[model samples]
Target chain A: MSVASQDTTIRTGRVTRALIYLTLLLFALFYLMPLFVMVVNSLKPLHEITSGNMMALPEVWTIEPWRKAWSEAQIGVQATGLKPYFWNSIKMVVPAVFLSTMLGALNGYVLTKWRFRGDTILFGLMLFACFIPFQIVLIPMARVLGIFGLAGTTWGLVLVHLVYGIGFTTLYFRNYYAAFPTELVRAAQIDGAGFFQIFWRILLPSSGPIIVVSVIWQFTNIWNDFLFGASFADFSSQPMTVALNNLVQSSHGVKEYNVHFAAAILAALPTLLVYIVAGRYFVRGLMAGSVKG
Target chain B: MGFLDIDNTTKSYGPVEVLHEIDITVEEGEFLVLVGPSGCGKSTLLNMIAGLEEITSGEIRIKDQVMNGVHPSKRNIAMVFQSYALYPNMTVGQNITFGLEMHGVPKAERDKAMNDVAQLLQIEQLLDRKPGQLSGGQRQRVAMGRALVRNPDVFLFDEPLSNLDAKLRVDMRTEIKKLHHNLGTTIVYVTHDQIEAMTLSTRIAVMNGGYVQQLGTPKEIYDTPSNLFVATFMGSPSMNLIPVKLRVDGEAVVAETESSEGDTLSLSVPNPSARLKSYNGQTVTMGVRPEALTDAEGADHRSTHIEKVLNKVTVTEPAGSDTFVTTTIGGAECVARMRADTEATPEEVTEFAFNMEKAVFFDPKSEDRIV
Candidate 1:
């Protein structure tokens, strides 16, 4: 309200604006630095890459390594390479993401809203699944899949991903739906919305951020899984993650560092794209269930 | 015939009984309010009528049809919850029409119903917005609109305005009363607010501890409460209760309180009823409201001549319109409503007058009204 205060307020506002821009610029560089290093390393020859100064920009850039990674690295469908492996990853991860998220939403809706005999016990089991070490069950799961004739097939990895993904997905949705008003469910019941109808019409449409979080979590988990894919998938049906590991592990005498980096980038791109697209909803879902009216 | 009848309804969750032998009949156009404090089984009773909660033992009939075990939607009753419960993702229009849409109402008819309700509630501008975008009053209107669009046989509201701000609560309270007046539909409303119960109901059922303490017209319940709980619960700045022994005069019963200075002042009860005959020479509680006590010399002639009762005003609170004087009498503090002109300070002895006609008596043993 005073002239001196007005001058100080304007000066402080200017400084705050500059600070915000500086913070945003630093954030951008933090996210971009790794991708920039990967791109530069993929373009350089082997000698320059191993020169121990990994941070420097390439003196000479060439597309030959990209071409070699595509052709000699054997990442194409035409020659049983990374191309078929990528398609195999998609085939397994898509169904796993879809089925796991659907089942998680269903499980969460029932655990929080419905009062059956053993619902609390079922919720305890779901929470228990989240804490148990996956390595302990790996052999048992492998044997079960083998008995079902699902081992060495895309369905095998899909089933495995679903089994692991459902625990976290259901936890995410159960907490999110807990903050919802119980009266909404009761109102729907009074309005003739039976179990599934209440889920689809009343609960699902309101579950925007939670659904995004479930999809992103399941997709990333299934896409990046090396142990399950390598253990269950055979040579013809293996995902790109297994193929990338084989290329790195099976090389003899000389290591193709450029091809390895490119393959690693390929395996990671799907998950990175998903995070970029739905990161806001994932964070929003984390904050959704902490408050109630 | 009654629109809805509840016959000897009892509810319990295992060994914890919530409601005991609740019998109520709702006429076709009555606005009945079930009023009580929290944990008094009002909401549980409302849920039973709506078929959302199972009645432990009872028969509920709506329009001559048994409603026990009926699905909530099949019972033809719509409830507006205290939380509003508007679907957060749906527009107000969609929320109002959700029940209708579920019952297979055509889109055209649904649209018309939505328009009519929006117009009725004066919320036409908010129809396209979700519940999160609206104010508390607007969301409350949308909730009411949802129930209104159903055109069901009965309406149940469970403390629907308790969540709003005080000013908004009063505004919506009038709006709900007007809606009930216009609809001529059977409505069973629940609230802990005695003011809302007093102003809005055709009849009120006061409950406490799984039992109906009293059920009658609002005026009847206010003038003659059935028990001590009803007397204290129905009034703001509640009635003052004083323990005293009754002495029999020639043709009347006189209540005598032991004075602090070792003396006794006997106040005569003019019309002694038969209930007072058994209570003579026995300890009982005499209830007097604040408004019934005043300065002995005050201009209100009706209260001036009852009998001179002297007590020390211990605390004084002047709330602009009236002054509340707290005084100790017979080892209990009794609050009296005095005019602002009375010059009474703390711990000062003052002569206060009482209107014995308005005083109620309750048996101390049972806590029930003597008559």
Candidate 2:
């Protein structure tokens, strides 16, 4: 069946359709080429990657590079794998994503539903954090982390990401909850639902789309963050990104390209997997807040 | 003490006063409706009663207890919001029982209450459905069920049927009136609709510009409005106010106005009060309802005095049940209701009967009734 139906306003000719699909395919292939190179070379021996074409398939297929990449990354006198750093990233991300999203939902509910004087000004101040450059806050964040003695711990990274993630998460949730009927909150109030109960039962239950948007956003940002990980974390607790950087920097004179490729993909895998699973919801969630009732 | 007493209550947003010293006592089983045009502080007063809004000054009492700092749920009040405001996540049964559940009612008790309210609202089959899945009318029932399940001391309805279609609104209006009749619950209903006020309210507080213009039974508000605003705001086509000079003769008082054809039409005033002496030779407003000024045959049979006058019809609008004949009387546009097959055409001279017994006069300066 033709997609350009009788009611479609902008009808395209067959030639135009062919040209459009060709352009889309070219862009898709262009974007996928790096991922393609990494996967193909990571399967081959290191010599084959250095001497062979990036576009060529691997002839000497071995899983040794994947295994070494998974368990062997040199960081500060220890021959530790990416595994501990991977755990560090997970430890940082889970708490940061969950806490930031929950706190954001609460902030949104209070700002929109239980309004007080100067609330708009307060909201504007909260939003100012979202636009503040990350580099500007690093010194102060480091000082605060040092004062709290969380300077090089996984929790320190969690705190940093949580503090930064709150602004964007609150923006998403506040705008989403603004469209939520205040009448519902008032009705729940009359129904004797207290502040926390109203948030847990009424507003949060209907906050599925915005929550997905927040979780994906916070997860990707906290997982892939390099500067925060490098600055705040110690050698023992550095996240995957920092460990990957160290591994590449300390490649022992001769380059181990296959292990590097596999390590790079390993560092990037979680976020990519997250996008594949929830990519549609991210797009849908963006639209839902702006348009859906 | 009354069931609900709003004594000297006022609400102001910062410096701007929205409700001014509103004092009204609602007895048990009284369906008191606060009706007005938009932004008239009706809903604000309702909210104040519900403790959803703080009373800027003075006191509100429910069951003889001051409710100034009380939380809404503690006030033993339930509200049906304009949007229905059902918890979208909950089923109809849960929606109805959420209040009871929050009050720490047991599971069995909550279930029983929900079932009872569902049957009462005739929404038993909709128990498992979410609010979004229900139709607007069904959602309205669920909202009412939520309110009714609480069985609070007072039921506050903030334009609950405003979202329904016209047909459903009328049906719901009847159902609400029936429910009030059966339950005899003290209700505070707020609406912009005068028809709903007339149909459902045992007593209505006609409000405008943050003031209650009149508070009385529907018949009293309709027949003897206390001011010009109440006269115009309470009726569908609204009461006609014509500028007329009062003539005080020996024993007869007459409302003096000139007809469209340059003929002086003198209509007699009924029950001429001692106040008529003060309004003599003064241009006052003659407030008469459209139904009071009709074709002679359609005039009220019990009306003691039906004064006849000739006026040129400006327009004849043929409504299905009746015709509204518009004409210039005393240099002001006035509507006269007549039979559906009203022969009065535009630009034609028509003889109209004015029910002098139903006539009221307002001092045009202060705009208050002069009786």
Candidate 3:
């Protein structure tokens, strides 16, 4: 009788697990539906998209919409391409991410290890910077850019991102460093290592997960940003997101839904690639960085 | 001038003083252990010596040179932390050699030093392994190797064996003592373990409430503790303190204590000091070790003074070689050590002999030893 009862329990456990998996699969599909629709419609020809079902695979797949979205689309007054703006984004993001991450590392090291009186208050004020909405800073930043004659330039956009991104990068690194053992730093000091030497040899080498976290966080934030990009950039320096917005909204002719979808996908490729390459570290970094010393 | 001297050191944060006027001096090769319970400022003192924490007031001198504001590296000291503090990203070899590399030592010299330390620590096989890959004992060795490669003027160890298991702790304790003997380097170790302090130190500074309560050899601290706190803190199954009245009985100084049943027990004190003579008719504290009170037949009869007392046994705890027999005296629980084979059952009155030659007296109000 006990054997039969155990068998019944095992069978019920299996059925419960199966039901959980079924529910998860359905939720996964629901979340993926828009992405599926975007890819399907982006691949379809204009005539097929106009008449065929949205859920169906493209009856006649074509690369024309992707081509047009890249080179021939109208973005604002310019009809050049997203290719130039894509280069603009690369120029803006590379330096911005690199500079902010370096500054944040220094900030974190000093804030956590070499702290002085009022340092905690200073860090708290800096943390307040991370929560401020971009709209709140937009006007003053634009005015500052104008005063410096940096308005509507790639450098101006880089400056804007750097100023705002430092807060988040600092927060990430500070949390990560707070959990790092402090004895290593003291040991290095006694080993005759000076400040920068300790940072370079001892601290930086152990900062792999946090570096990934800060870089990816800054890269995605600057890449997908539309408000700052549009406000700070001009005709020649607009980022890919702003250009994509203009490309879809410009109504020189009938709406090209397929081209719009392709353009949106093209604009999102870099961030998606970043996630796919280093996605595992992202979660690990977040979890490890949150642990307090 | 002493090799290392901490003179009139006091540490305070805001208005709260943590360590108050601590003074310690060590010879060239003395092993000094600063021992106390947690929050007793032992680690704070060590850190101040290492220059990790600033000294608020007082002068710290090494080799007769003042070291008040000297950087830790410039002061030429190495520390073995409780956590080991090996660089997790570096291999054992690199960890050992990092100090040399920081001082701009040549690659050949660094490697030579690293090899010597690794061999000394018997960690040559672990040179290529990262700290994360090594066991607790191996990591401890690597931490020591890191400090050893420096060959600094003084060595600081902060509870270095506290993280190990019980068995490993004992093994490593012996290893550390052997290492100290082989090197004969001046060492200042901090620990809360009384046994570690007693076994390792050439001189022990017993700290309490941030003050150096007593500074002496382990034997001196154990046999002639200066006060009530030091007497109780240094021993296991600590020294039993019973309230007693001192009286002169026919030229012999005797301590009189009352049992729970209102019977008086008188034990004669051997060689009572001149200072103890003033408290003839007043109350005082009598501290006796459990070994001093034992089964009558097995008691050491060679002592000059011994008193037999009959008390009802309240409990018996057999601890392998000796059994601790507990009985009530003057409303306080007193333990007597007995031979394990002795049949002193609980609830039966047993005759135990008390050796009074080693007993000490403390003033009731001040708690300071009378002599």
Candidate 4:
């Protein structure tokens, strides 16, 4: 009887439905306001952006700001734009994301299926690492990079992000793999598969959702990182976030508001593109391991 | 040595022992079932045989080869897990042939083996389909196919049918039995279901609290259960343990109990076991199966003695095929398996034809059968 009564409560009348959608649309536009400002202002010339209303459509559209932002704008006393630093961010983010996700996966597999004594404690310490302030590790991380002769290099940034990103990636993959059936691993063991074989053939293939979650998470975190970038990276190997900061702060006379806006949009593009492509999976992946199959 | 020998095996976790010393030898082509309640260590024993869990003590040998410290794959054993554990990413064909591929079998040989297993399991149509695309029964078949493809010396089944619907469980049970019959493989099956243990295994090891309570054939376990737990645990609705006063009636021992009508109902114990003589004058339990306590028309005519007692009926459940009549005997609720048209109803005093020949005595103190 209660179930039958729940059927009517599940549905809304036309007016209620329209009101709900209208409220949702209003919230959507409210959140999209910053992107709207950036896009509109970025397409206008410097004079128009300086003189005209920020949210108003450009009277004379121009791509000069974008072109300058891509190639000719002064970033940290260099007129090399955000292009070189963009590639640096890509180089750092890709390997960092790939290495961290893979290492996290291997750590997750070992922690869950091939358990040893004090493994929980080890996992607890790793989880504790996730909560540690990134600022606290910066000094030690810089020293370690110095010892390894990788300080001020793009690879140093890669190593820094990889180490920092491991905790979160392991947390994601571990939780996801924890819900995975141990019987399958045992079955694979009985089927004559070795450690890496079982991981590659059985575990990795089924880890689609969690992998997306890890990649997207690592990509965004590494790309958008400002603290680590500013603290470690030199002028040559500075990532996009640090370069974007220099681009915004370096101009002495004219503000170059359009150029700053254009550079800012470029700095935020990859993460935005990643979210646009795999955002749905991010939510689904987070929900997957929280509830058991 | 038998095909598979579990010789005095014990399993422990630090200070706690989960499975006591268990010893059972299984012949080649024999089906042995370990049936018990949850937390009874039945699955632990099966895992020991499969080399899944390390043995705490004693030896598990397959075909005279000591299996301690042996890898699971090298032990020539394949297990069907409770969840079926089909690799979700692999197609039916790849899933079945995984073991062969891992063992470095040639691709052509692995493909042939996979095809043979798929054909044997009648899953030829689902070859290209992933495990996620298959239904529960189909996944079960694929699990079996994976095991069957290996054609190992011993097959271990860990509650494999438990994940299916009741109807499908029964169907798969029959099919597994048929497959065993045709293949003549040495299978060590583990289930908490006594009916599955009864219907499938050539022999059964009824376990409780990490102990093998009784090990025997189905009829031996059913008719002559070694202890009180085995007597009650192996049957549906279980055996009724009626508290009765034992008294020597001339040459025979008689079990006397207070009926539902508040009258004395006496049942004779013919040809009592020699050890049962010591139980005279003491209050003991009389274990009787539901079928043994029936109406006049429902009684087994072959039995020489059918003690008649008029007891008050408490409940009558008409279950299509057999009507189960509930009545009180010896201060315990007893159920009698009656015919579909059984005349007994609640509140009415009906005559029960008790088959004393099927009754067994249990000592109240030890909780073991008075054998």
Query: Scoring each candidate complex against the real one, what DockQ results?
Result: 0.70, 0.87, 0.83, 0.83
- In the order shown, what is each candidate's alpha-carbon RMSD? 4.1, 1.9, 2.6, 2.7
The most accurate candidate by TM-score is 2
- Model 2 Cα lDDT, one tens digit per residue, B2-37: 999999999999899999999999999999999999
lDDT of 4 by residue, A104-184 (tens): 999999998999999999998888878889899999999999999999998999999988888988888888899999999
Candidate 4: C-alpha RMSD after superposition: 2.7
Over B1-371, each residue of candidate 3 has an lDDT whose tens digit, in order, gives 79999999999988999999999999998999999999999999999999999999999999998999999999989999999999888999999999888888999999999998888989999999999999999998999999989998999999999999999999999999999999999999999999999999999999999999999999999988899999999988888888889998666788999875678998888887777878988889998888888888878878867788888899999999999999888777888889998789999988888888878889878988899
How would you class the docking of model 2? high
TM-score of each: 0.90, 0.96, 0.94, 0.94
Clashing pairs in 3: none
Q: Model 4 residue A83 lDDT?
A: 95
Better of 2 and 3 by DockQ: 2
| Candidate 1 lDDT for residue B184 | 89
Error of 1 at A183 (Å): 1.1
Model 4 TM-score, all chains together:
0.94
> Between prediction 2 and prediction 3, which has the larger TM-score?
2
Q: Please list the residue runs of candidate 2 whose C-alpha ends up more than 4 Å from where it truly belongs after superposition.
A: A1-8, A73-76
Better of 1 and 3 by TM-score: 3
